[model samples]
Target: MEKEKIDAAQESSPGITRRGFLQTVGIGTLEIAVVGAVAPAVQAETRQRGNLVPLTLKVNGQRHELHVEPRWTLLYVLREKLELTGTKPGCDRGECGACTVLIDDRPRYSCLTLALEADGHEITTVEGLMHGEQLGPVQEAFVQEDGFQCGFCTPGQVVAAEGLLRHTANPDIGEIRTGMSGNLCRCGAYGHIFKAVQRAAILRK
Candidate 1:
C-alpha cells in the first residue's frame, strides 16, 4: 500500500524527487542567509554616500568648494574628483612616496591623507608646479638631468625636491640625500635624481 502511494506521488510530481526538493530548499535558505548578511552592509554604504561633508580646498593657487565623503583620501579627490592625474598612486599606503603632495609647503603622502583633514589648507600637487605652459624649475631640472628612468616616481621626486629646496635653498649632497630619503626610486636613479635636485636648487636661485 505504502509503495503504491509513493509511486502515485512520484507520478503526480513528474521529475521531482526527494533529493531535488531538499536541494531546492537548501539553496533557497542559503540565498536568504546571504541576502540577510549583505543587506545591512549595502544600506550602510548608502548612508555613508548620503552623508557627504562639505569641503573647501585651496589647491594649486585656487580655492575649491565641494562635497566629499569623510573616508575619501586626498589622493582620490585629487585624481578622481578634481581631475589632477599627476600625483601617482603607488602603494596606496604611506610607505611609498609616489603620491606625495605639498601640504602648506611640506611633503605629505596624499594616499595617507584624508580629504577632510586637508580642508581649508593649501595643497599643491605636481600640476601646481607648472608656470602656465612651461614646466617648473624642478621639473625642468629632472628632465635635463635625466632624474628618472621609468618616470613613475618622477612627480613625487620632483615635489619632494621642491619641498627640500624651499627650506634649504642649497642642500649639500648629504642634505639632499637626507631630504629626499622619504621618496624611493625603483629604477635605481638616485645619482641622477640628486643631480636634478642640485640643478633645481641652482635654477630656483
Candidate 2:
C-alpha cells in the first residue's frame, strides 16, 4: 500500500505535467513583472497626493481656488475639476493643439501645461470669448464660414484664432497661415477656416 501511494503521488505531482508547470511559472513571472511596473507608480502617485497644493487660477475673469496634485495638468483641472469642458484633450502631448487655451493672452496647450504652472497667470478659455450670451467675432466667423465638420476642434481653433487676431489686428494671408498653423481641423476645413480668420480680422476692426 505504501509503495502504491508513493507511485500515485509522483505521477499526479504538480511538476509532473509540463503544461501545469509552465503555467505556474508564467503566472509567477507575470505577477512579479506587474508588481515591478506598478509599485513605483503607485508610490509616486501616493506621494503626489500627500503633497496636494493650493492652486488659484484667474480663468475668464473668474477666480478659482482648489487643492491639486502636483502632477495634475491644466486640462485635467479645467475639464475634470472645474467642469470647464470646452478644452478638448485631442492630443494630450501638446502636438495636436486641440486643448489650446490662452495663458496670459498667449495660446498654450492646456494638456501639456501643469495646473501649478498656470497659477497667477490670466487664463482664458473658449468660454471667455462670450459676452453674456453673445458670441465673439472669432466664433461668429467660424459659424458663418462653416469652419468645422465634427466641431470637436472648434473651441481650440476659435481660441487660437482669437489669440492670433488679438495680436495682429489684420494678419495677412501669410501671417494668418503662420499664426493659425498651430491649430488643426481634422475635418479638412482649412479653406473655410482661413476665410473665417480673414473675416474675423475684418469683424474685429
Which predicted model would earn the best lDDT?
1
Candidate 2 segments exceeding 4 Å error: 1-46
Quote the lDDT for 184 in model 1. 92
Per-residue lDDT for 1-205 in model 1, tens only?
Answer: 9999999998888597665687689889977876878987678779988989999989999998889999999999998788788999999988869999999999999999999999878999999999998999999999999999999999999999999998999899999999999899999999999999999999987
Report the number of the highest-TM-score candidate. 1
Worst 10 residues of 2 by lDDT: 14-23
Quantify all predictions' global Cα lDDT against the true fold: 0.92, 0.89
User: What local lDDT does model 2 show for residue 50?
Assistant: 90
Q: Model 2, range 1-205, lDDT digits (tens) per residue?
A: 9999999998888555654576579889977877879987678768888999998989999999899998899999998788788899997898877899999889999999999999999999999998889998899999999988999999999999999988998899999899889888888888888899999998877
The positional error of residue 145 in candidate 1, measured at the CA in angstroms, is 0.4
